[model samples]
Target: MDAHSAPLPAAAMPANGFGRFAGHLDRALGGLVETVAALLVVVEIVILGAGVMARYVFHAPLVWSDELASILFLWLSMLGAVVALRRGEHMRMTGLVSRVSPQTRALLEAVAITASIAFL
Candidate 1:
């Protein structure tokens, strides 16, 4: 292949050095977030179930159970959202995006992201 057609060397590629480091950091954080989210779901289930059992079956309601659940639910939800964002699973108007040309689609995505950030 001619020089122009040849693939760039690893050292010369854009995705090396800091880009590669950032990619690895992103994957590591994503995996950690996913694992934490999954664990939170399980813990929440267990806490709620035990709380119910303690209240109904044993005739002694756990006074702090609801408060604990509320706090955990908030954390779990945030972690779940983080996982979704990292995995690109957040809500999107895919039908609208899919119908557009590539250039338009890119522009639409950029606009969507900017709007989301600004709204935040």
Candidate 2:
């Protein structure tokens, strides 16, 4: 059978205690990241709106709003990335990997993860 049609190996299943705990942790962290990203987006919108109102309607600019909005946007983007990664929704070029053997795929994934950790 091809990789796509093959059943997942037993080791790939999250049936053990540590695997369950890790899954729960990932979900919790993903939820937190989503919540924080949403809040940041709201705050950014409010700050931008207030800044615009103050500048055009009141003829006085809110000097700090722009900087605050930028910071909020940065955090929002980072948190969104975390959420995407947790959900396995992040962009990837998987065409070549999909055609490889399972062992090779696993090795490549391990190396990629290690490189990511080292880079971080």
Q: Best lDDT goes to which candidate?
A: 2
* Model 1 lDDT at residue 20: 87
Model 1: which residue pairs collide?
none
Per-model TM-score versus the true fold:
0.78, 0.71
Q: Candidate 1, which ten residues in sequence have the lowest lDDT sum?
A: 1-10
| Candidates' C-alpha lDDT | 0.78, 0.79
The runs of at least 3 residues in candidate 1 whose Cα sits more than 4 Å from the true structure, single-residue gaps closed, are 1-13
Q: Please, what are the lDDT tens digits per residue for candidate 2 over residues 5-72?
A: 35457688689899889878877877887988888888899999999999999999999999998888
**Model 2: per-residue Cα lDDT at residue 100:** 84
lDDT (10s digit) by residue, model 1, range 61-106: 8898889989999998788877766656667787787787878877
Error of 2 at 16 (Å): 5.3
Give me the overall lDDT of model 1.
0.78
